[model samples]
Target: MSTTYEFQAETKRMLQLMINSIYTNREIFLRELISNASDAIDKLRFAALTETNLVPEDANYEIFLVPDQKNKALTISDNGIGMTQEELIANIGTIAKSGTKEFIDKLQNHEHLNATELIGQFGVGFYSAFMVADKITLLTKKAGTDLAFKWESTGDGKYNIEPASKESCGTTITLHLKEEHTLDSNNEQNYLNQQTLQTLVKKYSDYIRFPIKMLFDIPVQESDSVETKQELKILNSMAPLWTKNKNDIKPDEYNQLYKHLFLDWQDPLDVIHTRAEGVFEYITLLYIPEHAPYDFYQKEHTTGIKLYSKNVFIMDDCRELLPEYLRFVKGIIDTPDVSLNISREILQQNQTLKKIGKNLEKTILKNLEVMLKNSRDKYLKFFKEFGKAIKHGIYADYSSHEKLRELLLFPSSRSVTEDSLITLAEYVANMKPEQDVIYYATGKDRQAIDSLPQIEVLKEKGLEILYFLDRVDEFAIDMLAEYAGKKFQSISRGQLDLSKFETEQDKASQDKLINENKDLLEAIKNALTEKVDEVRISNRLKSSPVCLISSDSGISISMEQILADVQDSKIKATKILELNPNHEIFKTLKRTFEVDAQSEQFVDYCKLLYGQATLLEGLTVENPVDFAKLIAKLMK
Candidate 1:
């Protein structure tokens, strides 16, 4: 006897939303149905572990699909835990218990939703079958129960459940494909053809935990007779890569598996397979690619890892497995503890997964550290591609800043001896006993920072300053305030208090020169009102006449320019001009200013000094073309 049931208001709304909207692509129906089948098999397996008699001796755990063009029916059967009459009504006939209300509400609001996005949230994936079929009929029998039941729905707010006769201890879902969806032209039949359905099954359900099989026509030759058609079987590979042992898998096998999973042609630079078995049991296969993908920096890019529960595919591109900063990593993480029907909202509350994620992040960072030590060349190559990401990590968290700082590499001034990039540890090792700080300067290139007049002062004090050419280097150093008890200092900022390296006589001579340039410095400072914060004679310059420096608390001019260019903000800080006392131009200026302190030529000389200082320090002059004319007039 068949009993028709009307859906609840929310259920009716959800059914309409799902049928008319929820799934953007109709082909996802196959994945949803196959996922339901896999879950059934998993339930059966779990039940059999405790109740042995419930499983049949010859019951092979597999899903089979039969396409009947003659009857217009596509039947998908799975030897898994089947539903009873009550379960059929509860699971299929009504969506009252399913969380589809929330899903429908979200979809109605035009929120982003995908098939996998709603999988664990609501146990109503069976409804996805309606996207492709006009009618769905489910024949099921509980494993130990003799009675069977049939649940049928037309995806129009009503369903029917009835007693049925079946000998199998599983479920069979037959989808009557709509007329437009039917593979054949015959109006009498209601199903997809064998070839079309098999292609759909393979494309969408290839990764289902349980074996998915389809019967195909193949040529067979009997003794003295040629048979044109015979039944042949195909089983999609359903064992996920993370389920395998690390030692049992080869490098090529892992690479090929990644290629198959992501359809990415480039090989991964490294693969980390780890199995954890303590408070939480999990298997993870993480991969680091040789180069970042085009969408690596995009906020919409998938997180690149699939999350699984109990060897069954749960979700693809599970963002909970990694933080946003580490989204470039690609891999699969399988944990039996995760709920099979977990929702995106539930993932946020999953403390165990959060802990697992934190541990996995630490493991990856430690592994990278090991690689950096053991394989320097390979690590350098990796840094060349992903080093900016590492720096980004340093800037992301304060707790991991020290560790990320140690992982950073920079060109050293002393590395003039070699082209090798030095780490913070190496920089600390080479630091002079009295030198209590690590100095670094950032610019467009190593040669640019090396040739800057600011470095001459640090070199005169016998300090080894690191040359930072990469844009990330400045941000990274800022995040890494200090290393190994030494503070990091930017040498282009303010006056260098080199009291540790100066003798009494050197200090006396510096004081004498400062006194002599006091009048000329004051005049120069007055000539450039808003430009120069202060004017002073430098004991640091050897070849260059002058250089520009920012305040001690301020960022360097180079860093300022970088920030300005990146953010497109107006330059807010002015620079101090420090003139060389021994240079000819400075001495001539001192003599001229001493004779006629407010003369026009003296003012022109001060402007030239300020413009030259800006030029020497890698900054643009206020007016480049006017500055050029001034230099020409001065030459004449």
Candidate 2:
């Protein structure tokens, strides 16, 4: 007797969506189906670990695909856990109970779910067959069950289940291919005939735990009879690299594995193998590449971490395995606790996956920290390649900012060595007692920051400031406000309070000199109106006559210029000009201003000071050629 079943109203809607809208790429249907077969095989394998009788000694646990051109049908069969009649209806005919209600609600509300993520999470493998087939027939007999059954569906939300006679302990899915699709004449008769499908299987499902074979039809010579057609076969390697123990893997093997996994040519700079046992059990094999991918920063770039459950490949490009900040990292994560039916959306919300992800991040940061401490030269090489990515991590998530700060490196002002980059930890270790904050100044280069009159004063005080030259340096420091209990203070921002180094009398003396040059400062500030926030006698400048500074809230002149070069906006924030009381120009300015605060020479002198400061800070003046002429006039 045939039994008729009406899909739940929600199931009907979800099925329609899956058929028409869920799958943008029809080829994924093959992947989905193959993944399901692999999962079925995995179930039997796991069960065999404890229940030997349940596993057939000669079962040969394999997935086989057979395509018939004459019949226009594709058959994918698996020697694994086949379902009973009731189980078939529950597992295949209906959606899983947990998500059926929500899936229906989403369909009713016209909400869309990513089909790849949905099928991966919901264990809806059978529905994927509809992508390439007008009809699907599933024939199966449960292990240890005598009664076999056939379930037939036209993929229009209706299916029929009836008794069948089969002497096998597995399931066979037959997809009657659409009229337009046919196997080529030159192709082999079996699964080997479809080279493209084999390549896709390798690309997406290579790591499946069970053996996948493609059956091909080829003419065979017989000794006594005429040539006859025989089945030819090929096996897809289902064991992935991450599932193996660290000791069993070689460096070259890992490289080959990563290339296959990510489809990229570059070798990785480092690989991290982590096996966590306490509270959670999982294995993670992560690779840090020597160079970033072409689309590393793009939204469309696939994050390379695959998710697996008990060595069975569940999903590739699983973002839940790592945060977007670590998107450059390529690897695999195998967890036994993760559900086989885990979907992408559910994965984002999975607490266990979140914990695994957190642990993975921790492990990577720890690995980097170790590399920096043990292999300074190697770490520097890594920093040269991935420093920007690390800086990106600092701005990516607040939770990881502190860890990223510890990983950042910069050039020190007092360090004479050009190649050495010091980390915040190193800087903090070398910091002088009574230096309450870590000082940093961002600019185009070290020489520019060194020549700035403001840095001259800091050098005079014998305080070391970090020279940030990379474009990402400023943004990183902005995100990482403090490290090791010391706040990061920008040296070129506002006025410096040197009370820790200079006595009160020295401060008072400097204040007196500033008061005396008030008129000259006012003339300079007025000449550079809106450009200079303020002009004052500089206690910091030791040799240079003047230097530029920004308001406490604004980025430094050098930083502003660097940003302007890359940023689309041509307009930049203004800067303040600070003059040295000890310099000869300030002495001349005082006398020149006393004669006539608005004299043409004094005005020219003010513009010259502002222009010189701008140049020293690595910025172009309104007229570079005019500034050169002004300098020539001044020299003459």
Candidate 3:
């Protein structure tokens, strides 16, 4: 008797989407079919562990492809665990039993979905066949069972199944090619041709445990003429690189593997090969790309690690294995102990896998620390490509903050070149004996940070400062808070104590200048009441006439610029205008102020000086047009 069934409503929708919509490339159908065949073979091998009578002990298991171009059909056969009639009805006739309904719901909800991982994790890869074929026929016989079953479908939401007989305990799936999806489309016959099938197998399933075989015709020379003979040839090596011992694998082999796996044309900057034998048994091979990809900074942060269990391909984008900041790292991780029977949602919280993630993160970081100390040039090249990502780790992963901090490098106020990157340790080693705080400043360009009056004073005292031009710089520093017990202080902030660096005579001179200009300070303070929080006598300035400084609790100019484009910032800016009190411009200005405490000329000088201070801090003058007129009037 034959039984026909209607697919669940959701399953019907999924079938249509798979057949004519969701999948962008029809070529992936071959890969899906190959993966399913490998999975069945794996299940059979596992089952044979306890039930030897299920199949002969010496039985050979492999995948074979028979192409019938004249009939427009291609059959994929696997000698592995086949399904019973009841299993066929439950697995193929419904969506709920197949774990695909939930995934479809999530896709429809428009969540931040990783389509590749979802499809790989759900165990519903069988549906991909609809993308290439309008009709599909399946023949199977469960091992050690007398009955066989045949299932047929046109993928129009209905399928029929009946009991049948087969020669072996395995499964064979045949696809009736659609005209547009066939090898005959666009004047090309390679799509369903033997050569094209072999190429697809090699590209996607070359590392499956079972050999993939195809029928090949070769020319043999017996005399002066050549004759063609049919031969069965293995198309896949079925060797996974991570499964091999590191000592036996050569560097060229690794390069080739990386090229094939990553689809990257250039060789990796470096590779880290690791294996574990104790508490956790696993092997991982990691690669650092030679350069950053164009989408490295995308918020989703593409996961590059391929996770496997007992050599069964689980997921290539299981991001929980590695933190988001390490998204640039490309690698494969295989473990024999990880359980693949549970749902993907629970698999992520698996205690054993979490333990592996922590250990792997530590291992990768230690490897980087070694490269940094040993290979200066190569390390810089790596840093040039992924420095910001490393720094981002500080903010994203607190557990690895200390390690990530050591790997950070920044352009220094002491370095001769703008591109030179220095570490905090380097800054400490070269710091002045009299300096107690680590000084840093941020700006849009090298010239702007260097021109800050605050930086100039530190430069005169032979103090080193770190330049943080990258937007992430401040957040990284905030995460670290301090390095080796020294606090990171912005030089543009108010009340940076330079008194410790000055001698008794220098202190006395600054004190005398402030005391003499006390009256002039009051005049300027009254003229610019709303422009600045407070008018103060400068203690750090030497040659420059004046400069602006943020309050000890206020936002620095650099941090302000970072958030300047934001519509609203919880932190407000409060700046202090500090006069040099010793520069020649100030000396003349003091004399003019003393002569007429309320003169219009004194008020203009206060406003003009404020404009100059704002410009020096890499900020814009509030009234550029009026400020420019003030300067012109002063010139006359």
RMSD of 3: 9.1
RMSD in Å for model 2: 12.1
Provide the TM-score for each candidate, comma-separated: 0.67, 0.63, 0.70
lDDT of 1 by residue, 121-211 (tens): 3446677677668788989999988999888888888888888999878899998876656754442222365566566665555556667
Summing lDDT over every window of 10 consecutive residues in candidate 3, give the lowest-scoring window. Answer: 110-119
lDDT measured at residue 119 in model 3 versus the true structure, 0 to 100: 50
Instruction: Name the candidate, 1 or 2, with the larger TM-score value.
Output: 1
Query: Regarding TM-score, does 2 or 3 come out ahead?
Result: 3
Q: Which pairs clash inside model 3?
A: none
Give model 3's TM-score versus the native structure.
Answer: 0.70
lDDT of 3 by residue, 104-222 (tens): 77556643444343454454567767767889999998887889999999889999999888999889999998876565634333456778888778766676678889887789997
Q: What lDDT tens digits, residue by residue, belong to model 2 across residues 29-99?
A: 67777767766776666566456788766768788888676688888899878889989878876665455
Error of 1 at 130 (Å): 30
Clash pairs (backbone) in predicted model 1:
72-190, 72-191, 120-341
- Compared with the true structure, the alpha-carbon lDDT of candidate 3 equals 0.79
